[model samples]
Every structure is written in C-alpha cells, then in structure tokens.
Target: MARVCVVGSVNMDLVFAVETLPAPGATVLASSMSRSPGGKGGNQAVAAARAGADVVLVAAVGHDDTGAALRAHLESNNVDVGGVIALPVPSGTASIVVDAQAENVIVVAPGANGHLSLSSPRLRDLVAGCEVLLMQLEIPTDTALAAARVARDAGATVLLNASPVGADPAALAQLAEVTDVVIVNESEARHWVWPVPHLVTTLGARGAVHRSAGGETRVGAPAVEAVDTTGAGDVFAGVLAAGWAADPAHAVRRACAAGALATLVPGAGDCAPDDEAIEDALN
Candidate 1:
C-alpha cells in the first residue's frame, strides 16, 4: 500500500439538510440535522485509507469530547493518529447546509485547526517518510507549506488540494512551487493559476482533467444519483493521492469514480467507498 501523509485540519461537522439554501438576509428551516466527523484533512485521510493506502494524518483538535471523537473516528478508519495533537481550544467546526439537489454551502470556524503548527519532530519525520503528502487549506497555510517542503526535500510526491481557496496569492504561489501536483475543483481552477508540475481539475459529474508538462488526460465519471456532495472532492483527492504513484491517468479515472460513489450516500468520510466498491463502479 502507498504511504500517504495528510497535513490539514480536523473538525466536527454540523450538517443540516434543507429544501433550499437560504439567501442573504433570509432564514430557512432544515429538514434534518446531524453531526459527523469532518474537515478536509480528516475526510481525505479516510478516503486514502479506504483506497488501500497506509495513511497518516498530521492535524490538531481540541481537548474537548468532539476532538476525541474526531481522533477516534480517524483511528477506526485505519488512519494513524500519532501525529494528531490536542490543544486547549475547541476543535474546528463546519456548519454545512445541503440542499435537496446535493449542493452545499459551508461556513467554518477554524478553532484549534487554526493553531496547528509543524513544530513536532515526529510529525516532520512522518511527513518526510511518506510516499505522497496530501494537504488542504483548512489548516494554517504556512504549516501546509512547511510540510510540503519537508516531503518534497525527502523525495515524496506532494499533492495540494487548494479548496476553500482565498489565501494570499504569494503564499499559494510559494506552495505551488514545491508541490508535485495541485488539485482543485472547476471553480477554483478558474480563479487561481499555478505553475506546478501537474494540475488536476475536478468537474463534478462530468469527470476530471489532468494536465502536466507532457500533456493532458481527461477521465469521465460514471453516472450516479448524488445524495450528498459534501466530501466528494476530498474523496477524489485522497484516492488520487493513493494511486498517483502507480499511474496518473488510471488514478484520475479511479478517483473520479470514487468521488461519484461518495455522493451516493450522505455525510463526508463516512460515505467514502472501499477498493471493491471503486472497482465495482469501474466495471
């Protein structure tokens, strides 16, 4: 199995299912409400693990019960939580509203995730030893950049999922410089331009495109009814990271399928498909 290290945030997600998302200055009632373990880092780590990778997560949570549950959830999913630290503040949280169409609007409170730093020697070693380092913008950008530098220096492939993109251009640019692959959704792709070694742009339902110095490869997604699209992109990123070392083109195809399958169920990490499910989707 590929050794994948994820450096990012851990949050307890508060999800509300609504008939429609509320506009500014408008209030809407939710049809259902639930809480789950989430956060881009946590979701991707679980996705990678399910895709048959040995995944380790470097993140932070609060000393609260929510934080404990988040760590336990990752552990249950076969992710190594040795690098996860607990801080005095409350854990990060995301308030997500999912519409009937599977579209979502999210607001995040960074909490302890904002305080995540890479000052631990063990965490640095973990990042350096991985075959691929996967990251997102949920944590401190500098921390992600620092982990990327470590992984890059140690000859590991670095993949950055630039989600929730609104970081400083210079910081994002510097991150792209050391990264081997940059993953972004269609909307994010249109906004930020990076001169990275490779770029993977995910088009929901349609498929995904991989562009490198050599050329470009496009893969189509299998048709599926999406129940919730919350963690689909993270699933794509994680599965892509897991399979990228063997074949970029094939990885993109599998990642697309995994992403589509993730939407077949509700919630984030909990809904990620296993290896058999991905192959079943492909066949």
Candidate 2:
C-alpha cells in the first residue's frame, strides 16, 4: 500500500432535514436536525483511509468542543491528525440542508480553516514520505499548490479533486503541470482544458469517462445503481489513488467500481466502502 497525504478542510456539519428547500425569506419547518463530521478534506481523507490507503490528514479546526469531537472522530477512523491545527477562533462549522430525496444544500464558514497553512518544511517532509498527495480547494490555493509542487518534485503521484466548484483556467493549467492525474466531473472538466492527459470525468449515473496517460485510450464507468451521490467523487479519487499506488495499469476501472459502490450509501466520507466490498462489486 502507498502512503497518502490529504490536505483540506474539517468542519462540523449541522444538518436540517426538510421536505424541500425554502425560497428566500420563506419559512418551513425542518423534520429533523442533526450533526455529522464533514468538510471536503476530512471526507476525502476518511474515504481514502477506509479504502485501505495509509492516510495522513492535514487540516484545521477550531478549539471549540466541535473541533475536539471532530479530531476524535478522525482518530477513531484511523486517519492521521498530526497535521491538524486547532485554533481559538472561528471554529469550523457548516450549515447543510438535505431534502427527502437526499439532495443537499450547504453553506460553509471557514472559521479556523482560514488560518491553516502548510510550511515548506512540512510540505517537503510529507511529499517525501507519501506515495500520493491528494488535495482539494477547501484549503488556501497557494498552500494546495505548494503541496502539489513538492509532491511532484518528490516523484509522488499527485491527484487533485476539483470539487465544491471550479477553478480559474490559468491556475488550473499551472496546477496541472505538477499534477499526475486530474479527476473532475463533466461540469468541472468544461472549466479548463487539462495539460495532463490522464484525466477522468465523472458523469453521474451514466458513469465516468477516463483518458489514459498516453492520451490514446479511454474507459467508461461500469454498471451500478446509484442511491445518494454525495461522496461518490471522493470515493472515486480515494480508490483511484489506491489502485494507482498498487498497480497503475489497473487503477481506472477499480476506482470507478469503488465510486459507484459508494453511491449505494448515503453521506459523504461515511459512504466509502471497504476494499473487499468494492472488489466484489468489480468482480
């Protein structure tokens, strides 16, 4: 197995369940309210760890009780929290609304996450030690770029998940120069052309489309029933990283199967399936 480093965000998700979303200023009663451990970085790290990757999580959380609980949760799941910095202000929190159909709306207040930064020494160390460096936009752009550069320089494969939203074209291209594989959905792919030929575009139920490194071959998603599509992309990235680390030639198909299997469950990181489960699906 390869060592994987995840640089991203961590937050306590306060969720409200309702029949449907309400328009501005319109009042609607929520059927239930709950809290869950979430954030793009944490979710992806958890997904990768659960998928059998040796994972280290680099992130930030506030000094509040929620932050403490989040750290405990990550530790319990066997994710390395050595990179997480706990601060006194702006505790991490997100407001999420999920409808009966499992559709979701989220608002994030970065809080302590805004204070997170990765030093050059730390970056170099992590890049040197890990086989794969996975990142997201939830952290500072410069920090994420720095980590990618170091990982690329250190000869570790770099995978960037362009999620939560799109990126500027110039920045995206620059990032691609240091990136080994780029994973995005159809909408994300449309934002900028990738310089790296090993790109994968995830298309919901229709499956995902993959362009190989040589840029001559392609692959598509396997058959599966999707329930809640929340963390499918993260699961895809995690499984893909695992496959690439173990056997680069077989990564794409195995990754697609794990991602599709994740869709059968609900929630983000919580939805990622074990290796055997995904392999069984692939078989």
Candidate 3:
C-alpha cells in the first residue's frame, strides 16, 4: 500500500439536518443535530486508510476535549496521529447544514488549525518520508506549499485537493508547480487556471473527468442513494492517491465509485468506505 502523509486542518463538525437549504435572509429549524470529527485533511486521511493505505495526519488540534476525541477518532480509523500536535487555543470547528437531498452548506472556524505550519522540524521529517503528500486548502497556503516542496524534493508524489478554492493566485500557482496531481470539483475547475498536467475534476452525480497528456477520460459513478455528500470529495481524493500507486489506470474510476458509496451515509469521518465496500461498489 502507498504511504500517504496529509498536512491540513482538523475540525469537529456540528451538523444539522434540514429539509432544504435556507435561502438568504431566511431562517429554518433543523430536524436533528449531530456532531463528529471532520475537516478536509482529516477526512482524506481516514478515506485513504479505509481504502487500505498507510496514512498519517500531520495537523493540529486544541488542548480541549473536542481535540482529544478527534485525535482518538483518527487513531481508531487506523491513521497515524503521532504528528497531531496540541495547541492552547480551542479546537477548530465546522458548522454544517445538510439538506434532505444530502447536499450541505458549511462555515468553518479555524482555531488551533490556524496554528499548524511548517515551522516545526517534526513536520519537515514527516513529509519527507511519505511516498505521497496529500493536502487541502483548509490550512494556510504557505504550509501547503512547504509540504509540497519537501515532498517533491524527496521524489514523492504530491496530491493537492483544492477545495473552497480561494487562495491567492501567486501562491496557488507556486503550489501548483510542485503538485504532481491536482483534484477539483466542477466549480473549482471552471476558474482553475493552473497549468497542472494532471488534473481531475469531479462532477456530482454525473461522475468525474480526468485530464492528462493522454487526453481526457470520463468515469461515471455508481448509482447509489445519496444520504449526505459532506465528505464525498475528500473520499475521492484519498482513494485516488492510494489507488494511483498501485493502479493508475483504474484509480480515478475506483475513487469515483468509492465517493458514490460515501454519500450513502451522513457525516464525513464515518462515511469513508472500506476496501471491500469500495470494491463491491466498483464492481
């Protein structure tokens, strides 16, 4: 299995179940409420591990109970949390609202996650040793760039999942230079000007598209009843990184199938499909 090291944010998600998304200047009541461990980085790490990869999360949490539980959750998922540090501030949090259709809207409060950076020599050593470096935009862009540079220098593949894609153009371009594979959704890809040779754009329900030197290939997702799409994209990125090391040709397709399976449940951390489940969905 490929060894993946993820440098990104870790947040506790406060989720609300609603019949539909609230429009602007409107108020709605939630049918139910739940909380769980989540964040783009944490979700991807769990996704990779469940997909049968050796994964480590290099991020931070607060010195609070939420942080403790989130750390424990990652360890329970077979992800290495040795690199997860503790800061004095509160743990990061994401307030998510999931509609009946499983689509969601989220707002994040980056607490200790904002403190994670490449300043720690421990992080440097961690990124250098991994076979693949996976990252997302929830953390500082400079930190992402630092990890990408270190991993690229170590001859490791760098996979960057650009979500909530609103990074500075110059900094984003620099990160793109070191990134070996770039993953984005339809909206992000539309405005993505980075000249990344290898890119994958995911279209919800419609499936995904892969663009490379060999040209573009489209893969349709498995037909599943989506319950919540909170972390489906994170699952896609993680599966792609793990599968790329073993079977690049089928990785995207395998990942798309896994993503579809993820939407069958709610919450980010628990929704990631295991190897057997992913295989079953793909078949």
The TM-score of predicted model 3 comes to 0.98
Residue by residue across 1-283, what tens digits does model 2's lDDT show?
6799888888887878788888889888888887878887887788778778899888888878888988998897789988887888866788877677666777888887777777646645865678899888777777778888888878899988876565566777788888887888888887777778587887765667778755544455666655556667777887777667778556777677777877777566477888788778777
Point out where model 1 deviates above 4 Å: none
Considering lDDT, where higher is better, how would the candidates rank from best to worst? Answer: 1, 3, 2
Q: Return the lDDT, model 2, position 238.
A: 75
Candidate 2: Cα lDDT at 178: 86
Give the TM-scores of the predictions, in the order they appear: 0.99, 0.89, 0.98
Candidate 3 residue-wise lDDT at 44? 94
lDDT of 3 by residue, 112-188 (tens): 88888988888799999999999999998888999999999999999999887889989988998998889999899
Q: List the residue pairs that clash in candidate 2.
A: none
lDDT of all predictions? 0.94, 0.77, 0.91
- Better TM-score candidate (1, 2): 1
lDDT of 1 by residue, 98-175 (tens): 999999999999999999998989899999999999999988899999999999999999999998889999999899
Best by lDDT: 1
